[model samples]
Target chain A: MDSLTDKIRTLCTGLLKDGKVDMIVGFKKGTIPMSSCPCVARTPEQAKELIWDSNCTLNLANYLTNRKEKIGVVAKGCDSRNIVNHIIENKVTRENLYIIGVPCDGMVDKRKIRALFNDDITLFSEENNKLFVETASEKKELDKQDFLKNNCTTCIHRNPVIYDELAADPVEEQKIENRFADVIKIENMSSDDKWNYFNDLIKDCIRCYACRNACPLCYCPTCFVDESNPQWVGKGQDINDVRTFHLLRAYHCAGRCTDCGACEEACPMDIHVRAFTRKLVKDSCEIFDWEPGLDPNKRPALDTFNPDDPDGFIK
Target chain B: MKVIKIDKQNWTGGIDKSRENYQIFGPVKDKEHFVFKKLNLKEYPDMENALSVLSPKSILFPQSEKILAASLDESQDDHHIMKRVATDYSPRAVIGIMPCDAKAVQLVKLNFDTDDYRDPYWCDAYEATTFVGLAVNKPSIYDFTLSMGSGPFAEEGLDVLLVDCKDHFLAKVLSEKGDAFLKASGFTSEADADKSAKLINEIKNQAEKAIDAEKVKTEKLKEKSLLELHGASFWEDLSFSCINCGTCTFVCPTCWCFDIQDETKGKKAVRFRNWDSCMSPLFTLHASSHNPRAEKVQRVRQRFMHKLKYFVDKYDQGTMCVGCGRCVVHCPVNIDIREICNTMNSYEAEQA
Candidate 1:
């Protein structure tokens, strides 16, 4: 797995030196422990700073939106999927992208790891399947498999659907047994319980739009929250307004979301914001027999109407 | 000024008693993080933790609040007119607030409260509450409060400052509001003022010394000019990783920008204000669609300049930041403000 880092830098520097792409977008060492930051390298020298690790949780597809310069981006399974979504949606030109793909294992959940260390993980290092953590007083090693983020644990794709270059050999896709169990739980609840469940889920929202900004699908020039002619949602701290914003934002990505966990990772509040988007993913899977971002030629479930589809709900 | 001591067991009793007269806002453990909640009767504040995910600023300047409301009913004479919303401005107490967060509220008050104009909602909320702060005895690596003029034990904005002595809390009452709050809670046992002062100074010195060891100083920032610092070439590299999300501003104790809008539900209209961030492109967008800060760099530059330069020039007090390190810890990309502050502070004017 460490060999992938060398391959990434080699590919990035080659592109930059040969003028194959204007910039190489990848991950760099983060100032915070157990995290990696997104980086864009214009010079070959800067490409050496790039790192490849499980901590590269942010989707590189987020950086590809409407970009003018030809870019070489490092993508995992989820990121490559989102790139396909972007190309199909006409958000970006596929010709301009040089996708360097990585077969992913999973990303760590910082919250879960922190709890394991009693919330004092200040220093960290990773080995084969063990994570070494330290506090001011002591150090400990724990199994990394126990701390994978919820989205990554259920990921069906471990290899990129589309890519210009492969940094390493592809890994096998997972057989997720309970992918829709959470959404189904909420679906079975009574109307009042479901309403209360979702309301409490988003009770801590500060309306910072981290969830929206982190998503590759949310590329609108003017979001509904900023519309003035007929403001769809109020900007105040009202719980109703907060709930309205989340529900509407989730619906906008009904068939398009890749379930990449970028929104959940970017959220400072640690909200399970995917609780709303995953339901859409389940609907697309069960009703339309569709998986988004797998094939660009196929339209999303919501984008086109089928004559054979049930017509009673259309009206 | 007076000093009092309250037993650890009686902390809940104090809060339980205070609920008789004052509404209580305090930090409570919420799943993986802590949040400031309006506690129900007999509920005790979560004093076990030193900091919360969101600061206590929402007590005075909530993320969302109603300022005015209107009705469309034809029978009323004031129909079609907006009227001030009925709000409870009665005495309230926010316990378990950090001293840095309290100082941030005071810094934000300079914007909401002024000689020429006043924000009625914030001002009213400010006047109606008593701030009870908890001093940080052991500071984190991210804490630079000592370098920013507000130490872990600074009492500039707090009415009653509590120093945890493990078994009991040494309460230092600094203002009349502190006296009223203490009285309501039935905390009548007074401690020796001189003894309490000596103990507080010991913790204060140790925490400040720890911060000084980090050496993330800000004294040089005051000497730099806005134009020279703004033109520095490092800003592009510094802001490169930024996703332009509102995580930094929303978690900050001092950031106070807001956007106001009206919402109508069944002919009843409400005017409310929600938190806004300068990091967003929409923050500076004009009605003509001509945005001056259209680029992400401009927006990023505005946040640091406002905290480091604009606020310093406008207030003549200090930088708007209290250095609580919420933004430093919670930034998705690990864009530390301490590094940016150092860059701006030490930036030399280019040779002409």
Candidate 2:
């Protein structure tokens, strides 16, 4: 892991000194204790500040959109796929970006790691292929594989889909399998049971809208729920309104959602909002044989129209 | 212009008599408040009470409707797909619509029609409906000036304008549709100059009072740097208690975000559009699982900024709120937009 970090620092410094890129966006030691946050490196000296390890799991491609500067970004297999998807969506041009691809073994779930230490774990670090966590009075060493995030465990893409440079040894791709077994299990249940499950989940909603704000694809100048001229839903606690909120969110993500799990992670209520999203991903794959963010060449299903596209709900 | 004298007692009978042909939709007492309902003379007993909680716009711009449907069969001749004809609209009359709501319909018509990019779905529904505007005699729940401009009577696009006075009602015919409806209803009396003057004075006085009472004091807030105040502690304090349920935008009269979906059952599928909001994290989630506005503060800022800034930039309108106080009253934690605006305004004033 230290060797990997050293390699990243050396490459970033060389890229800046050579004027290959103006900005290098990567992970920095977070101000908030034990957190890893996005940071920008403008010079070779700033490259020393870049950190990469089990905690560096956030998809940093989100910062590339709406930016005009030539940027070099660190991309994991999943993050690289999203960047490619962005290129296809016309959100970011490929010519301006320099991608540093890293073969990922998946990163640790910080939330789970913290909970394992009973929320008292203040600081932690990776060394010698083991995770050393420090609590108030005690320190513990655990296997890195034990703390891997759920999304990383079954990752099929261990190699970057798009990269101008490689920082780590590449791993062979794993065959894609049913990644949404948990979501489908719940879906196969009775409608009443499904309703009960979602009702319990949605009832805990605090309406912070963190999920929407965090999503990179939710870029719109004006959203319909804010329009007043023909107010579609009332600003009240009507269950129908809440249902409409969730249902509409799932529908919008039907073909476009990349299944990054950012919405679920940012949610304070811990509602399994991803359950419905996974269903949409499953449906899209089954019906269209397409996965979002996987290819730079393909157009989005929603934006592309086929006169022969299925439509049977009208009477 | 005509002054029709139908005693309050006989008004129900008149509505009931009219229901034989036209569908009568009006305000009916619902628990402690009134709501728009399909008026049946036997069930809905009140006419001149309060405005229904919901505007009459939905009769034309429905809350949810199917736009297109199709069936696909892979087994039949190499994936054969069939689609159904679009839904047909029936002409209907919406009575007791407020002047602001009538104006809103006209706004929808202008946007949905003039731009070569027209919303055929909305236009088809709108064309089949007749707008019967009711002038307000007193201030109801919504304060018109804070949101919509002050107006009590429709200037255009109204089939019939019903002006309620203390003694009798003055009905103005604005279009051929209005004249034809009145003629078919078998009632008529030409309005004199004195009656017209009285009705005009009453409308003007009531509208002015409503505007004065509900006017939002935004001068101080407008002076502050909105960008500088983006990450202020005020937002954290206000949003801390919120549940993030999306009730505020759903109940708001002006919120119009929508989502399109495809539903398929037994080889049949249909595409439909439903309402959506910026408050959900999934609202901006990309296919790659990247989100930009990932914080609660950003989401809260968007709601206010879009209302006060973006909408004004898009449409040449100010004050994106009606001061209906519904968001304040309906929000579970009582996070009020008015209170936020006032607090920001005061903070700006202090800085200034």
Candidate 3:
């Protein structure tokens, strides 16, 4: 890991100095102990600040789109797949991007990791493949594998599938269980119960549109709901509007969602938005044997119509 | 043609007298904002003050209309199908249409008339309606000067063009529909040659000046390639402040994306279309659970690119965005489209 970090620093410094990139967006040491935040490095000196560790869990590829200058960004296994998807969608030009692919041995859920320590853990240090957390009291040592995020448990990709530079020895891929137990649990409920459950969950929505904003796939110029000439959705708070919003969102993401959990993370109401998304993902896999952000060459399922595709809902 | 004068105060009386004969619709105050609604001549006496918050397109393409309805039956050893019903379009008058909206109705007409799957519902409604376009002596708060080409009024498709000439409105019949409507009212007369010339000159001058201003600005913005602007630092800066509430698209006059779904009961189903926004993560979500655009910045970029690039490429005309500034006023974070255009202009200048 030390050798990998050094190589990354050298590559980033050269890229910045040679004017190959305007900025290097990567994980940097956070002010809080043991955390890493996304940092933009414009100069070679700033490149030294960049770091990669178990704490660097953010999907940094989200920032690469809509940038003017050539940019170098760090990508983990899942994050690299997202970049591939972006390239396929023409959201980011592959030629202009400098992707540093890093093999991740799963990231730790910070909230869960923090719960193991005192509330006032002001600082943290990583050395010799061990995490030393400093709270108000004495320091505590913990193994890196104990606090892996839930998404990592079933993550099939551990090596960067696409990259200009490799940071670490590529890790072998793991087999993942395709069963969406959570969605199936909800699906097992009676139709009336499911309706009530969805209604109760969606009724709390203030329509802030945070989930939409945080998501990476929604890229339309004139959203249908916003059209005024033939007004689609009314401008007021109605149950129909709320239902339409959620149902439409789910339908839109039917095949494209990457399961980054960013929407759920960004949601203020703590609604289990992922439950519906996971259901869609599971259904897509079951019906089409397709997973998004995995293969960039594959055409989107909805955009490509198939006569053989099941249409039980359609008349 | 002789010009006739009616006291501004008595215009309402004229409308009231005509109310018994025509189904009059115009802008009416709805709580805080104004919307086009059915006007009772006694209630909505003045039509010259404010612009209608809602476009008059609803008269042609209603908010919700049944495109198709079907029923399934198994007892007869065959599936039974039922056809959707059409709407009745009796004679009606849509009063106080701004120029942009008038143009929009015409644009929609082109699509309905030429498309393979023609919208019979709107076509029938448009054939039966008479448009009374009022000149915009005052600019709307939601004006899209650059995209709209003309400021408020474009004198092309209106049946009757009403100019606010202080004491009396100077009315000109542009089409046969206007002629028939005026004759039926018995209150309108042909304008004198001098008055007609003056009104034409005024409208031409206003439209030309607005178009000229837009030409200069749009040309400057067009100098930069939208593809190059994709990765600009300015997008990050412009988008970081955006709350992604989607109010900007909702308030836009030209935005027209929709999603269709079916609601079913007892083997019967009604398919309905609802508005969908690109700002939401699900807009491009394929059934395979892969979204190519997975970030807010990409979504934001797509919005501007469609307005400035894709729309122009698809529609030979500028997608008819008569710069109604509804997006500016309605956006929760005040992410103004004008600012985005200006930013694009400046960014191009900087690059150059």
Each model's backbone clash number: 1, 49, 36
Each candidate's DockQ score against the native complex?
A: 0.63, 0.03, 0.07
lDDT, residue B312, candidate 3: 54
Q: Which 10 consecutive residues of model 3 chain A have the lowest summed lDDT? A: A262-271
lDDT of 2 by residue, A255-288 (tens): 7777666566555445667777778888787766
The alpha-carbon lDDT assigned to residue B254 of candidate 3 equals 58
Local accuracy of candidate 1 as per-residue lDDT tens digits, A1-315: 468889999999999999999998899988778788898899999999998887899888988876799999999999999999999999878899999999998888887877665445579888787888897666988787888889999899879999999999998888988888888899999999998998888988878888898888888888898786566666777788788889899999988888999899989988999999999999888788888999888888888998887566776
- List where candidate 3 sits over 4 angstroms from the true fold: A1-315, B1-10, B13-22, B40-46, B49-53, B72-82, B108-115, B140-147, B199-216, B220-226, B229-233, B345-352
Ranking of candidates on TM-score, top first:
1, 3, 2
**Tens-digit per-residue lDDT, B1-352, candidate 2:** 4444334455555556656656666666654345665666576434463544445555665445567776577666634343434765665566776666666566555555766777877787777666666776554433443334435553445788777766656677777766665554544556775768586677767666655543445554444566656646667545543435466665555665666655566877766665556666556666565777666567777787666555544675444554544455444334667656666556642353
Instruction: For each candidate in the order shown, give its overall lDDT on alpha carbons.
Output: 0.86, 0.65, 0.67
TM-score of chain B of each: 0.97, 0.79, 0.82
Task: Name the top DockQ candidate.
Answer: 1
Docking class of 2: incorrect
- Per-residue accuracy of model 3 over A85-152 as CA lDDT, tens digit each: 78878999888899888888787655566567533356666665577777656678877667676667
Interface Cα RMSD in Å, per prediction? 1.6, 14.3, 12.8
Superior by DockQ: candidate 2 or candidate 3: 3
